[model samples]
Target chain A: MDLKTLTIVVVVASFILYIAIAIWAKARSTGDFYVAGKGVHPIANGMATAADWMSAASFISLAGIISFAGYDSSVYLMGWTGGYVLLALLLAPYLRKFGKFTVPEFIGDRYYSKTAKVVAVICLIIISFTYVAGQMRGVGIVFSRFLEVEILTGLIIGMGIVFFYAVLGGMKGITYTQVAQYCVLIFAYMVPAIFISVQITGNPIPQLAFGSNLAGQDISLLAKLDEIVTMLGFNAFTAGSKSTTDLLFITAALMVGTAGLPHVIVRFFTVPKVSDARKSAGWALLFIAILYTTAPAVGSLARLNLINTIQPGEVGAVDGNLKYSDKPSWFATWEKTGLLTFDDKNGDGRIQYYNDKNESFKAKADSYGWKGNELKVDRDIMVLANPEIAQLPNWVIALIAAGGIAAALSTAAGLLLVISSSISHDLVKGIIAPEISEKKELFIGRVSAAVAILIAGYLGANPPGFVAQVVALAFGLAASSLFPAILLGIFNKRVNKTGAVAGMIVGIVFTLSYIIYFKFMHLELNNADNWWFGISPEGIGSLGMIFNFVVALVVSKVTEEPPQEIQDLVESIRIPKEV
Target chain B: MSSKENREAYWKANLKLMGLLLSIWFIVSYVLGIVLVDQLNTIQFGGFKLGFWIAQQGSMYVYLILIFVYAKKMNTLDKKYGVED
Candidate 1:
């Protein structure tokens, strides 16, 4: 079948599947809505968490970033996965033992102050909204590309699907649907990766394929990719050029941020027991690792394939590589999306894809009668364009499109649910109207979810930058603010309301202001001119987290300990037997 | 020690297990992946360098194993401490 027809079929099938799950898992009570009735099997919850955790960034952009940025991008892989260790070890079991419906609930009760809860709610909103915006944009991109619809149209359709399920099923329906999404997305991701790996390295496992020798070549895949990219003026694929300190801070920020994210932490609350929460985190990581391990392989193989396809022979051939006239159909198709663009800078009909940034390489291109870099490859296109790059079956390509949309939509739905719940349940019911009825609260939740979707859709329609970069900002904010506060609130009984609230405010303000100043406001002076302590805005959040820890500790020491009742609450949360 | 003191000793051992695991957590990623990466790079694994491996893949695999290890060991500790859940 044609790609368009196959894409439409996949979309319709996925939509039907989602609606069915939502209807089947329709939440009956506030408990069902908030914590999936707290009966989710560990493995099932693991699968759902993987789907929720992967999001559009993991499914679509992670491999792409690695493929292009090479070793400098290792920060993303380590940071994201490392956070799960923190979650499993430090936070999950205790949070589960706390037996709370939401993260804010744990904070409020632990700190013995509604003010702490309010700060947490605000942090949650900012972090989740920042996160949801990226997911919404990812949904729009996938929809527009595969379904041949306008970006806004795709976003609206995405919103409608999320609204139908999230409004009806809440976390319960979302969890089941996420399981289905996990299957689709992982299958979609692996099939193309496996095909490419086998094609390149005669290996099926992407992780091993990366280290294994390339087909018809004695060199390993990474070795070959390193040789090729460096030959083209790019740094060796396995070597990092970024400052070690910066990379360290970014990795730290991402790890803490992952632990701090409200959506992920809240997932632990869905399990039935404290031990199950601990086990579920391990299971979730195991599931996530399936994709994470494969990601580097995909990145390396795709980078190799991309270089090979564009160059099509040994570099510096006198007769020149294949003409632009002979470029693959995939190239033309992606070019239409503006993700892959080509300009015959020298007015020669041949395309030269190389590092225009490297002076030495630029000299070689000039010596070889090549013009300025002819290929302008956007990183986002790498995953979307993978199937076509491998010349895979049309259905696999269609499946990838569907999978990408599933990844984006599933995460957007999850984020929207959390945002709506924080507003309707935490802020409105818990604080504003403590006497609100369950029915009224449920109504507010549904309406707020729909409205949140609209706002996310608007942001996605006009995204600020790369999806992953925007997500990094979200992670930075969460790491500095929510993670520290939550960690202290759970583990340190002396972390009174003053400490918790002050920590969150200071952390978020420091991180957000650093980002705004460096990334937006101070850029007019040039990037090199502005940063504080030589820390880029991307890594400054780690400094903010440090500040948060210090302030929280100092404030806690100065302030009275939390009331005895709150101290007992903390002790109860720490002991699994109580729950 | 009295039987009550023996029970307290068991609890202390469990806490000690947690302390050890937590220390490993800080050391492996923070110390190896970040602080000692350059020094570790003096060592090699396969064709790749050790620091690169830790930053890219090694730490993650270790993290996975650490959780299972923590869980398994903690289960034994829980039983000893009469705190199994």
Candidate 2:
């Protein structure tokens, strides 16, 4: 089959499979709707958690970010996966033992303050909304690009799929569907990676091929990549470009944020026992690691392949670059998206894709009669275009579309669940209508989920940034606001209601303001040099978390201690118990 | 069910285990990947600068091991305290 037909078939098939799962696993009660009846096996929950955790950022854009950013992209690689350790060891089992329906319920009960619960709900909405927007955006892009539909049309379709499963089956449906999604996405991701690895390095294991010497060459792949990128006035692939402080804090922020994310944490609540929660996290990371380890290989190899495509021969040679007229079909395909562009500067028919901003390369470029770099390749296209760049078969290209949609829809459904439950469970039932019936609660949950998806679809149509950057902000906010509070709630028993509320406000406000100032209000101050203490805006959340910790500790010391019942609540959550 | 003293002991053991595992987590990802990256990069291993490998690949492997270890240790602890629900 041709590319377009195969893409439509695979994507439609996956959606049909998900809808079937939703029908089969429809929730019958509040228990099933909230926690999948707490019967999910550890391994199955692990797979679901993996699918829940690996969003569009993980499936579509992580490798692309790594492909272009080179060594600095380790912030994403380590930061994202390492958080599983925190979840398994520090948070997951305890939260599972708490047996709450939502994160705010735990905060409310543990702090013994409705005010604290309300604050937690607000933070959860903001973080989840920011994250869901990126997933919705990914859905729109994959549909528009693969199916030749408008972005809004794609978004509405994506929202409809989410509403079907999420509103009907809740966590029960999402769990089984996510297990299916994890299989589809991981298969889709690894197949192309293995093929490309064999194509480039004469090895099938992408991880090993990353370290292996290029075929028919003595130099290592990283060494060759370093040499070529440096020649084009870019940093070596082996060396990171961001300042050290920023890298440290950025990685830390992402790690802590991953542990703190409500969507991922709630996955643990679906499992049967506390021990199951602990083991399930390990399984989830193992699954996630399969993709994580393979990503860097896919990244560096794609970088090498792209350069080889652009410059068919030696780098500095006059006749080395591929002529514009001889460009491949893949190049033309991406050019239609405006993501890849070629201008014939100096009237040269060949494409020159070097760093035009490099001062020293200017003279050499002028000597070669080259005016400026004439090709603009968007980083996002790296992964989307990788299979074609390597000449992989049509079926594999179609699988990439299926995988991206699975990833986006799974995560969006998860986040929207969190949003809806926060409203129906935490807001409506917990606060506004404490006397509401179970059926009414379910009705509110379904209604809120539908409403949330519509808002998310609108945001997806107009994302502030690409999938990964928007996710980075969500992580930063979660790190600053939620992680600190939850960690203290579990580890330290003395944190009072006033202290927790004060700490959360300080964290969310400080992190949000710093991010906004640099990201939107004053873009000039967003870089490493201008950053406070050499920590970029992306890394500033660690500082905000620290401020929250210090402020909470000081305030708790001066104020009245938490009530005895709240202390017992903390102690109860620490140990495993039967429901 | 366990006595107050047994429960306290179990919680303490959990804290101690978490502290040790988290320390390893911090040293590998934060220390090896960042603060000591330049120093470690001087030593090459398996076609990678030590720091770069630790940052991208090595730290993730360690994280995986840490979770499994924590889970296994917690299981035994749960059994010891009769808290394996």
C-alpha RMSD over true interface residues, each candidate: 2.8, 1.8
Q: Best lDDT goes to which candidate?
A: 2
For each candidate in the order shown, give its overall lDDT on alpha carbons. 0.84, 0.90
List ranges where model 1 is wrong by over 4 Å.
A464-469, A524-529, B1-15, B34-44
For candidate 1, lDDT tens digit of each residue in A250-326? 88888898898888988888988877888889898998999888888888888888888878777888545658999
* DockQ per model, Cα: 0.46, 0.72
Q: Whose DockQ is greatest here?
A: 2
Two-chain complex of model 1, DockQ on C-alpha atoms against the true structure: 0.46
Candidate 2 ranges beyond 4 A from true positions: A464-469
lDDT of 2: 0.90
What is candidate 1's local distance difference test score? 0.84
